[model samples]
Target chain A: MNLIGISINHRTSSLELREALHLNRDEIVSLIPLLKEQIFSEGVVISTCNRTEILGFPQTEGLDVNSIIGSLLQAKPIDGIKPEYFTRFFSCGAVKHLFSVASGIDSMVIGDSQILGQVKEAFEISEDLDFAGSISRRIFDTAIKVGKRAIKETTIGEGAVTVSYASVQVVEKIFANLEKKSALVIGAGESGELAAIHLRDKGVGKITISNRTIERAEKLAEKVHGEIVPFQFLKEHLHNFDIIISATSSNELIIHADEIKTAMKKRKGTPVVLMDIAVPRDIDPDVRKIDNVFYHDMDSLKIIVDQNMQKRKEQIPLVEKIVMEELVGFFNWYNTLDVVPTIKSIRSFFEEIRLDELEKIKNKVSDEDFTKIEDMTRRMVGRLLHNPTVKLRGFAESGANIKEVLTNTLILKELFNLEDFPTNGKSDAEENHNSEGNDEKN
Target chain B: MSQTITTLNVLLPLLYLTSFTVYLYDFFKEQKAVGNVNRIILFITIIVHVSYLLALTVEYDHPPITTKFEIFSIIACSIAFSYFILELLTDIRGTGAFIILFSVVFQVISSIFIGPNYKVPEVLRNRLLGLHVISALLGYSGIIISAVYGVLFWLLYRNLKENKFGLIFNRLPSLEILEKLSYYAAVIGFILLTLAIVIGIIWLPKAFPDFSYFDPKLTGTLFVWLVYGVGITSKWIANLYGKKFIIFSLIGFIVAIASLIVTNSLARTFHSFY
Candidate 1:
């Protein structure tokens, strides 16, 4: 029931290392059996673009990281890399790391919403391969629940976390509905094309792509199902579009204040949003002074992105609280697994003594008196065992130090002379032999 | 029965104040749980308000529209009811703070100035007049809600334009949703106001042969109706929307409020039952 993990994420490894360490679906499937044979009893591997984590339950006291790494290299070998590139976590730290990763708090983009599905896929693959045991399955299930709870209960996923998405959000703030609005992309460059695609996805009715070259604009317009407009006609038809995204490479302003003024008149007081995502600036900054015109550049869009990022960061503590609470619940349940068999042993020991003493007196008593005496002895045995059973369960749930609870359980086993009690259908003699071997190894 | 009414007089305002506080907190905090609590308090407040009105009707043996206090109470209840439906439909709770605040003020005023033994005029006791008053008050409530939405639209519009990204910008609905809601509310208000005017015109001469068409309240009501009518027509026909529509609704609500104040305070019309 000891958990261990190794993580290589964006913070700990370079992109090249992460790419090299990443496990494909086939590689993960092939690696699970080797991981179970060499390193752990059960294991799961979560591989995404930003991170690669291998979590496992070890059969022994100390985990051999090199054996796990050796198994991974056997699946997919790399030329030159050492084990130091991967950060390792044991037990509680490992569980917490997985929880945070599943909750999307540890993602490169906070609350990106893709990591949870990745974790679930990893767990499913492990389960299919018969590499996941009861403990690992419970951990993954609880992690998934925590992830969904974080999303549903908080505003962490409310706003756009990227600049391209933020551009659409800005347009949404001005116009109530994008369904009736039209957009114009001033350049067919990467940023401009991304904005156009986002606008299309947001259900903007019409999109027109404009560039100095009609060929590139035509290509982009075809992809987004937009109309191609000539570069020269940009100012003439600016009034027809409710949103304008400009990301040209021009060092000079492509759109001027006077041009927007003329377009505003033709627009008849309708609002227009102009986004300038270029470096040297595309739309004239002074055009922001016009009435019914909302002009934002890369810096302003970044502010929105930063604000959304900050909001998600603020929710990290709340998500962490939920994760910690779930972890406590899980560990409490796990602790009871250790105490349960012993409690059963002690109860049976008391019942056996009470029954033997009752049998010895059965032939010496009348029928009514025999029944009464039997009932009284049964009640005494039940009362005598109730407090100890309650206390043992309380200890398990109290989240006390696990080592101390284990020591107490061993003491009870010796004191009650119940070392011969079978556990998990294993004779006490075999269990003792296993523990002695583990102690000798330690 | 009297003790029950007295208890409600104290209980209703306190409940409204509690709801107002919760809504205001939710508006600023934007927490989902706080919003749920605010809605629950508002629902309870509406129930208590209805009970108070029903008890008053039972006590008076008539509809509870014969006094100034009763009219204001009904207006507050109507606004709450309308807002509840809108909230249920749209899931927009940010504007509840403003609407509930207005209801609290109206209810507080009604409770403070309530008269126990006010009598309905003989001619005004007809069911038609009661319907007229109720429709008029409901219409006014709708317009007031529309005006609140209009203000929110402008606030969000300005915040987005300035790139301030302040609390209001984060909390309020998009400008388009607010504009549509305001437009819908104005349309409802316009139809109800039209009904009130029609019923008044039909019942005026029968109730008061000496009723003058030149009465200030009558002209004021007509003028308010004309404003909303023109606003809605412009929005529907000319595609005049956004800031212009919001401004139009705000102006109409302001005029309606002015007419109400003038009719109650200065005009000597029979409509001024208060």
Candidate 2:
């Protein structure tokens, strides 16, 4: 089968656009059947926060891959493919892209390394559907191996890549030592908990976790060996802590100037470090003005994150080299698809001839003699064809295009009069997004 | 035979004392070599110091950490050891090195001026005296480390406010780090030092009620406790974090160490120059 891919990713779309294309598991089930009704479908869809893509092994040539894309996207195919956002790659190019992504070599944060498992799940879903093609099978496994190798050979995954890690670094940078200090976490959200864990490792004497939901605060506190502080008690205890990290989803500011001032009075002019990870910002901006309080809000965090993204971008060329080598390897195997069927059919023709010859011998012999004749003929055929068949497979595997000469000469028609095998192994016309003119390029 | 040491026997403490002055200079100036230099000097001094203690050991027929001079040196060693641990925990050893050096100097001074001689007071010749001296000194070492970092905080803070971007910032921790380190050391030292102070109070009258309450030991002991106590409470309730608390700690530790030297002067008559 001929293969092709179409994708639109985070680089091209906003969150609104990504959500528009999101497919639930049940939706995928029903959508596949509907897509099958419109065109042949040996296909898999990958829908994640970053990208949505379709991988199809089409059964027929000259099918419009984009005609089927309309079922998902808005407007005409050409306009819908905003040059900035969408890309199309065929066969080998598609395989390489899949592998790099599965390996997390293509991640915005290189070696963040979550994509391998995500790719595995996608493979499993396709396997359960019994729709996994050879290219899909080999590339995914290789991608996972490459992902692990990147981690092993390079320090790619070793350092702090996440915002959470950087946040901890900032706190530790200021406090010189935090072992005896108490730390207060204002929210029990994921980011807040992560900050707490980082502090806990620093040997902060006491950790206070307070969430709007007391249960969550208690649970998170228990894991980190921290105490559960009541959300209301935060102001009173604010002066008690050396550090405060806020990640609560509060619309209003959680700690205002007035509250901080009171806390400051209790603190005997000792400074408090405040880190606000909340989106709307839990700590009032004015709280920053309080002498001895160091306040950093979400905006500051974003600047750090943006800088990290730039740093990751600098690592891309190295990853791209790996992607290119793997792509070339996949393409060599892909381009040799033509010779496989020729080798298979040549063996089949020889077998047919041996059987036909044995039937003739049977007609000339008695019933008991016919059985002996059948066994002898079959053994002779294997002895004659085994070497040539093995050699032909080897030749095909080594990138020889034997099928091209065979097709041009029409030797099978002249000798055995057999029709050639159909060109592609899959049916991908179901949602063909290709136009007629595009078929000539392949 | 043990070698004879004269008034210049005081030079053993002098070696350590002069080193801290270099460190304090390096603290605000060429800050990079403080830890490395201090470590090398401390090692050499400790080796020589152990010999000094050994000579006194031979005279006393026991570990000579009891006498004020030997006790001070031992306290210096304890400060150095804690500084060693601090170095391991955090690489910000530049700030803590000065305090360790200070401890060494004071301990050496005690050994030279108070109990440099082989003779010890009969009242001071007990196992409890060793326990009291060693424990109190070690705890004082922690207080000393914290106070030094506190001084770093003051330097860093003032420089930041003055917007000097000065030399101290380069060598020392940012005010934040100083605050944290000082607090951590204060808490640990306070716990241990408080214990030593309490035991000494209990044992004092029995051994020598003549050791007056107004004596340098009483004042010095109380002063050390107050300084350490203030550091701990600042962390808990007072907005005492960062540079301010650290500065207070530095100043407090300085007074405390000086008071301790004066207290050691009480053991003057019995000890002779070796």
Model 2 regions lying over 4 Å from their true place: A1-4, A10-27, A30-43, A56-79, A82-85, A90-95, A103-121, A133-138, A141-286, A297-299, A310-442, B1-133, B144-184, B191-222, B229-248, B256-274
lDDT of 1 by residue, B1-274 (tens): 8899999998888998999888888888777777478888889999999999989888877788877888889988999988998999998888898888788998999998886754767776698988898889889988999999999988887777777877887788888889999999999899999999999999999998988999999999999999999999999899995889999999999999999899889879877665
Evaluated against the true structure, the overall lDDT of model 1 is 0.85
TM-score of chain A of each: 0.77, 0.64
Interface RMSD of each: 1.5, 5.1
Strongest candidate by lDDT: 1
- Residue pairs in steric clash, candidate 1? A176-B176
**Candidate 1 wrongly placed segments (more than 4 Å):** A13-38, A58-85, A125-131, A185-190, A193-197, A205-240, A257-268, A339-442, B61-67, B272-274
TM-score of chain A of 2: 0.64
Q: List model 2 lDDT by residue over A146-217, tens digit each.
A: 666655544455434555666665555456557767889988888988888887876888899999899999
**lDDT digits (tens) for residues A282-366 of candidate 1:** 8898988887889999898998899999999999998998889888887876676677678768877887898899899989999
Looking at candidate 2 chain A, the ten consecutive residues that score lowest on lDDT are A430-439
TM-score to true structure, per model: 0.83, 0.49
